[model samples]
Target: MFDHVVFGVSDYAASKAFFLKALEPLGVMLVSEGPLGIELCRPDSQSSLCIRRVEAKATHLHLAFTAESRGQVEAFYRAALEAGGEDNGAPGLRPQYHANYYAAFVIGPDGHNIEAVCHQAEG
Candidate 1:
């Protein structure tokens, strides 16, 4: 569990756009924004996801957020693509992970592996 997580990126605007689109389907909204960074959170949640501008090496971390349905996962994929995120994996069911395990993966501007997933399929 995280209270908040901040990502350091090369371009603040680009990262902001990527996060906005990818997180839209999850009901995440912009809580705050400035020249330094952008902070987004669920409408009724206190937890925050922050993207800040900085100079650092891109670390490899996979962040998978749950989706209510396969459609939501697919929407995230499309939004991420339109926002300049590189597709790591398309939306699909990975039986190896679980019976449902529908997910989509993308590489954000900071090189972090971002994903949207759902677990609502039968065996």
Candidate 2:
């Protein structure tokens, strides 16, 4: 039901860097870029991630990324912190989001809510 997702950021350079580092672990790459936004794509997929600079929206936006494992989720959280992201939530299981929903949330450079999640029983 979705063709693509476009996130509005305050600074293109900062948001671009943040996304590059945060999504690198997922095998996503920036395929194209322009003044409007940077287009990203999976290693061999057509779908894209388009990030652009825009006036901050009144409504908060939340984006969730799937991690290959819990470890990746933790790494993403750490990387986000290292990249100057404000901590929203630490990597851990959250029954509220869902049973065995191990995830982490970070405030992106654009001030948008970003999340990395792993949905698997922790055993």
Give the candidate number with the greatest lDDT. 1
Model 2, span 21-101: residue lDDT tens = 887766678898887989987877767779877775424689888787898898888888888789999999899878889
Q: Which runs in model 2 stand beyond 4 Å of their true positions?
A: 55-59
| lDDT by residue for model 1 (50-106), tens | 877887665677888878888889999999988898999999989899878999999
What C-alpha lDDT does candidate 1 achieve relative to the native structure? 0.86
Score candidate 1 by TM-score against the native.
Answer: 0.88
Candidate 1: the clashing residue pairs are none
lDDT of each: 0.86, 0.83
* TM-scores for the candidates: 0.88, 0.87
Q: 52, model 2: CA deviation in Å?
A: 1.3
Report lDDT (Cα) of residue 29, candidate 1.
Answer: 86
lDDT of 2 at 93: 89
